[model samples]
Target: MSYKILAVNPGSTSTKIAVYEDEKELFSESIVHSDEELKKYQKVTDEFDMRKETILNSMNKHGVKEKDLSAVVGRGGQLVNIHAGGYLVTQDMKEKLVDASTIEHASNLGALIADAIAAPLGIPSYIYDAVGSDEMKDIAKITGMPEIVRESFCHVLNSKAMARKVAAKAGKSYQEMNFIVAHLGGGISVSAHERGRIVDAIPSDGGPFSPERSGSIPLNYIVDMCYSGKYCKREMTKKITGMGGIKAYLGTSSCLEVEKMIEAGNTQAKEIFEAEAYQIAKGIGELSPVLKGKIDAIILTGGVAHSKMLTDWITDYVSFIAPVVVMPGENELESLAAGALRILKGEEQADPYKK
Candidate 1:
């Protein structure tokens, strides 16, 4: 029997919904909500109700009823360090993804969107590989100082895709290859994948800031910044996650603009962009020993992976370990749907992404 699936990837401002009948898409919509409309709600939790209701309105406008749905799926959120894949959803998962204390990322609202619509209709809602999607080896997990903190990382989606593609070229499965995958978008994530899992990664909260993220700041410095009568937890959230990074340095988020400036002989832009790419290259270098020098590929993925300039930069430096492969563009929608297919086929046991 064919089933109609309603999949969602709700972000901080926009909500994207895709309805599919088996392998064919029936309906798709992207709701680019106004900031004013979004800001009307005082808190991120408040926005949850608004976004869910909006998606409902969208479905209804298209004459799609919740009762007619087959499966429900949404993005995963509230995870700090996680690998990426389709994680099936459950009630226990819900509590883990939502935190009144910690502000929500765009992904946080994924479950809420599904819960608002699917539960009433009695449809099963699944979170396909919300985070924590790859496998890392035992030793990669042990590159630690022992005690106090162990480095754990996720956001393994594109990286895994990259590994699979390169592995096929070498007549190997992803599990049989050792690779370092770097996802360079607004935020940068570098991970080491061995035997099909990402066991080691650099956490944004751990270090290396990105275009919009603050990356890792020293604890003592953060404490001083907090007490200097200049910042609050709220302000810090905006700075670190939103207004900081490349924009903090250059007043814009467009890498296109940054590249333009660099081409026009803007030394500072060249310096920052090169520095960011160099740091990512170095991130791959750091993961080599973890792979025990069995590196087969260095992968570049994410939005910034589309940048020829950036990919070439990383390739030039990281080529010493292995030939670099670039998987261009953000495939979150296809990725989301691909995950649902994996679960439906029983290739993966659904472990819904919760809070």
Candidate 2:
């Protein structure tokens, strides 16, 4: 029997679908959704229905239908302490699917799409390496109050990229070595991988902020800002992400734009830009102890990791502990697809999907 695996990713304005047959990609398309139609959705949960319908319609245009799918996989939303791996779809994952408090990530609908369409075709719906999947152990969950770990983190897509780049150079599989991979992307996440499993991590909560994320901040600063009446708590809280970090100061998120000013000899731009990269480097440095110098490589992966100046700076400073391997850009889609194969082959166990 020919098993067709469908990978769906929901973006804010579009839903991307990739059909794969085992390791081979058959077709890929991005279905665009208009903002006006999306705005009509009273709840974020409606996006699941909207996107499902959109994908169904798009598949029809190509003469395919929901029944053709054998296995459905997709990007998942954030959930606490989820271990990375393929997971069997269940009702538990569905509840969080509709929860709109964390993020309205279009990718969240991947699992839902799989859920709705897979049964009719006798296919299983699965989530591949979702953002919620945290391979980190209990120790990494610290945020403060002995219970809280004042830390930050990125995601699997970023860490795996770094791990692969470094592992190849190290002449070993990423699974064979213990490493601390820090993903400096829209949001930063660092993980301590013991052999193959992530044993610890610094979550973005109460940790350092990033260019797109206010990584972590002390409550006192937040309380002070609130009591001082200079900033609104609700507004400031939002500022810790979307408008915080580089966007807060520069009104732009593109590192390319910042580097242009640096090249033109803008001192202030140079300082702030350099400082941001430095903070990421500094974050990587903190993870050194977690690996206890047994760290094989310092893997930098993300859109930001491509910065020549930033990579060089990290290499210069972090070289003493381990060599740096930089894998710029994100191949999250491919990674997600690959993970599904791992699960199907029984190479990895099916984990419980959060959302």
Candidate 3:
């Protein structure tokens, strides 16, 4: 029996919703929220009602009926670290998402909005492959400093989806192969997927610098700058995440613009762009040992992976380790839908959310 599924993925300024009839998409829409409209909300959770209403209205406009939806799936948000898969949205999960003490991210609203819409219909609402999916071994969490330990925080949803896609194309199950997946976009994360689980990863902040993030920096330099009295804690944080990398050097976050500059004979732009690629290849190489050099493939994905020039450069460096498959774009909506479909078809079980 075919099941109709609704997938909700909330971003910083938009809520992306899609309807899928089994595996085929019926309709999808991105409900963008302007800065002026979003300013009224003190926290990301406060925009819940508005996002949910817009999603429902979009569904109605698209000729989708609420009663026909077999299940609702949402992009999982930041919660206590859990293994990868679909989880039934529970009150325990919702509470953690809205808890002021936890980190505030736009993604935190995904499950909340989905639950609000699905609960009334008496249908299951699930969060799939949450951003905080942490399955790293304890040994992988070690750091040089005893005060710090690495945590798993990468683009789990898209990364896992791409991995599974590659596995299927190779006529093998995900659990039968190992992969090193790099998600390159505004932020970048390189993970070592051993068999089915992510055994280790270089989270966005600790990996190569991306369009906006500074990635890993020298600890000595960071400490010196922190106490330099040049910037406050928040400002420093912004410098590392929001205003660093390509934007810091070239005054723009767009890789396309940098490519344009290269074509226009800007030597600095070319150098910086190459440097980013160099760092990415290095990051991929770092994960090779984790998989013990037995990787089946190295997959490059996410928005920035669309650039042939960038992907080509990275391939040149790391192609020796394994074949580089360039699969661009973050297919997040489809990933959510597929996860829900798997649960609905009894191909996989939906894990319960626990605090």
Candidate 4:
């Protein structure tokens, strides 16, 4: 049986919507929201209705009716940690998405909006490979300091999707392959895929620096900076996750712009760009032990993977672990669509979202 599935992914500045018939995508649209436009909303959740309306407008423009949909799947938001795969949105899930105590992210709006759209039609709303998916082994959670334990908060959606893609290309089951996946975009996430499970990962905020994120800085200096009081709490947070890394050094987040400057003989741009790639390779190498040095493949993906110069720098460092497979761009929309189709086709079961 064929199913019309709508996949919605909410980013920091855009809502990406896609309609699919099983594995085939019918239409996709990225509804971008400028900073100036989003400033009106006090919180990310406040834009729920606005984003939903935008999605409806796009769907209407594309001639896709709500009643025609079989299932709606969204990018999992800031829910509690759970295993990988599709989850049916229940009342519990909705409450958690809107909980004030939990972290607020644009993706959290995905399930809320999906539920609203699917409820009236009595169709199921599901979330797949949410940002909060946690599957690390117990030992992996331990940090040198007992007070702070490591959390699994990397690009689980894109990393797992690319892992499955490369595994298929190699004629091997994802559950049987040991792979290292580096998702380098505005942020970077390097993880080890032990078979189908992600055993360990260096999340964007805690790993190598990216185009805009200041991955891991020295602990003592960070503490000293915090005490120095040059920045407030919010500004300090932004420094680590949003305005740091190459953006801090070059004053722009676009890798292409940085590359252009590098081509024009900008020594600072050239060195900073190479340093980002070097750090990415270092993060990938750190995961070698997680897979016991028997990695089947090293997969490079996400937006920055499109840069041959950057990917080459990373490949040069980690090619010894396994064959480097470059799978540029994020496949999150397809992954969400496939997860819904899997449940609809009885190939996979949708798990309940428990608080």
Candidate 1 has what TM-score? Answer: 0.84
The digit string of per-residue lDDT tens for model 4 on 278-327 reads 89999998989988899999999998899998999999998988999999
User: Model 3, range 19-85, lDDT digits (tens) per residue?
Assistant: 9999899999988999999999998888988999999899999999999999999988887578899
Off by over 4 Å in 4: none
What is candidate 1's lDDT per residue for 100-136, written digit by digit as tens?
Answer: 6544577777876776677888777776555544454
Q: In order, what is each prediction's RMSD in angstroms?
A: 3.4, 3.1, 0.9, 1.0
lDDT of 3: 0.93
Q: Once model 1 is optimally superposed onto the true structure by TM-score, how far is the C-alpha of residue 332 displaced, in angstroms?
A: 1.6
Worst 10 residues of 3 by lDDT: 74-83
- What is the Cα-based lDDT of residue 154 in candidate 3? 90
Instruction: Using TM-score, rank the candidates from best to worst.
Output: 3, 4, 2, 1
The lowest-lDDT stretch of 10 consecutive residues in candidate 4 is 77-86
Candidate 3 residue 90 Cα shift, in angstroms, is 0.7
Kindly provide the TM-score of model 2 when superposed on the true structure, using C-alpha atoms: 0.86
Q: What are the per-model numbers of colliding residue pairs? A: 27, 21, 0, 0
Show the lowest summed lDDT stretch of 10 residues, model 2.
Answer: 148-157
